[model samples]
Target: MKDIITNIIFWVVGAIVLTVEFTFKFNDTLGWLLTTIGVILIGIGFIYKSKKPFKYLIEFFINFF
Candidate 1:
């Protein structure tokens, strides 16, 4: 119950922040923080959901640089 309440609070705060962010000029700190979190979450999702995610990640880095 406590965890669920905490999660709801976090979601509400996140939504309010996003609304404020969109209403005003872009915020660099918020942008980077959200982007980094999004990227990491997506990476983790891909790794756990895909059968050959590591191979793709390695290939991407090798081709990137």
Candidate 2:
């Protein structure tokens, strides 16, 4: 239960990071770094057992475009 909440936080934060990267340009290395970290966080969020992660990803992509 705690882990679920924690992972959800991970997912949300990652989504935010990705969004920021796409919404605003940053220093080249900084943008790449944030993107890499954001992807890693999203993967970490998916490591737990739950459909919520997929739902979050779907919503993120849908809203992203």
Candidate 3:
């Protein structure tokens, strides 16, 4: 119950921040960057939930870099 409530609160706060970003003439670039990061996080969460091996992917990138 506590976890669910916390998750709901977090989502609400995130939504409010995004809303403020749009309503006020703040830094658009920073807002876009935040949105992009949020998208990446969602994708990663999906991949992790699906049991995909992400460690190998990270290792491959590390090797390339």
Candidate 4:
């Protein structure tokens, strides 16, 4: 149940990102960056059993934003 929720969340987020990337006339660099980050997130979720290390990226993004 938890895994299903996790994958769903990842998929939804990825889809939203791709939609934004394709819909906007924004920076190509930023679009590719979003796609890469989304792929990395899906990879990490598939490859790992735990979600502990995500805090690092989350914190980084928080600071980045």
Who wins the lDDT comparison? 2
In model 2, the runs with Cα more than 4 Å from the true position are 48-65
For candidate 4, the lDDT comes to 0.68
Candidate 2: tens digits of C-alpha lDDT, residues 1-65 = 88789889988999999999888967789999989989998888876666676786688679989
Where does candidate 3 have its weakest 10-residue lDDT segment? 42-51
Q: Model 1 reaches what TM-score against the true structure?
A: 0.41
- Span of 10 residues, lowest total lDDT, candidate 2: 47-56
What is candidate 4's lDDT per residue for 1-65, written digit by digit as tens?
Answer: 88767866776776677777678835778978987877776655543445565775577579989
Question: Would you list the C-alpha lDDT of every candidate in the order shown?
Answer: 0.60, 0.85, 0.56, 0.68
Query: Could you give candidate 1's per-residue lDDT for residues 1-65 as a string of tens digits?
Result: 55445545554555665555566646688876765554554455435444587897898789989
Evaluate residue 40 in candidate 4 and report its C-alpha lDDT on the 0 to 100 scale: 70
The superposed Cα distance between candidate 1 and the true structure at residue 60, in angstroms, equals 0.9
For candidate 2, the TM-score is 0.67
The residue pairs found clashing in candidate 3 are: none
Which candidate model has the greater TM-score, 1 or 3? 3
Cα RMSD to the true fold for all candidates: 8.7, 4.7, 8.4, 8.9
For each of the candidates, give the backbone clash count.
Answer: 0, 0, 0, 0
TM-score of each: 0.41, 0.67, 0.44, 0.54
Model 2 local distance difference test score: 0.85
